[model samples]
Target: MTMKILISDPNKCNGCRMCRTACAIRKAGVCNPEKSRIQVIQMDECDRYLPLVCQNCEDAPCIAACPKEAISRMDDPVLQTVIDYNKCVGCKMCLNACSFGAIGFDEDRGRPFKCDLCGGDPLCVHFCEPGALTLKDSAMIQYDQARTSALRRTVGIRR
Candidate 1:
């Protein structure tokens, strides 16, 4: 009943870029990373490939900042944010507002592009060669549990 976002561990990613190719193929009908919704920024010296995708934030600033209301959470159980291209005004407000740098400009369509989680079955997750990406439930209870455990060992929070 909770929406999920995938994150890549820098240690796991090997700069293979299979995720980027998969994203492009699913979104653009091609295997070109240049047109891919997801991007893999390679830090070659460090042997790392940072897989960048939508974080699917609970308080999504992009949704609030869209002037045309083109971005909306899907009614499905996963509740992914979907951009209605027809309604998008190409103002780039959402792109600027997204802190994760997940949004990209579609030069051909003149609209911003972002990961929609592929309607619950993310191709990036499927095609991640190193198993660097995963779609897990974004549960508040789980987050609270982890936070509480971390805080208990820290000097900041007593409880």
Candidate 2:
């Protein structure tokens, strides 16, 4: 089976926030942006809205940061990093460890949450009116090397 990934095209996004509402409803049964796993951040400097979600890093910092080993990468076809709520200790380490600010903290639940791709059918992608969010096979998309370089620069990590 081909590995699937979620892609966000900022150029296509109009900041409508329908994606956030869909995600929140699917995940939390509410239309709250704060509860949405996917977030659209407005870049005032560029007047652009960027939808941010977990990149599913090969070496996910959130997994390593969880002291209770609650966060882990699912094997094989899924390839998603998930948090074991039973084992999670309500720590915000995963939120801090995320480079893209993809992790969200739930104040009521006292837990951090990230995108799970909605078990292979993302509501965020479906509700995205501008087609900014897409689910594509990993093999079909060309990797952006500049993104890696920029991430390293942002984190001050040389690798």
TM-score for each of the candidates: 0.79, 0.84
**Total clashing pairs in model 1:** 0
Each model's lDDT comes to 0.82, 0.88
Tens digits of lDDT, candidate 2, 27-88:
99987888999989997777689998988998999899999999997775545788899999
Candidate 2: regions farther than 4 A off: 142-159
Worst 10 residues of 2 by lDDT: 138-147
lDDT digits (tens) for residues 54-150 of candidate 1: 8777789999999899998775655478889889999999999999888999788798888877877889888888888877766865896898889
> Which segments of candidate 1 are over 4 A away from where they belong?
42-45, 140-159
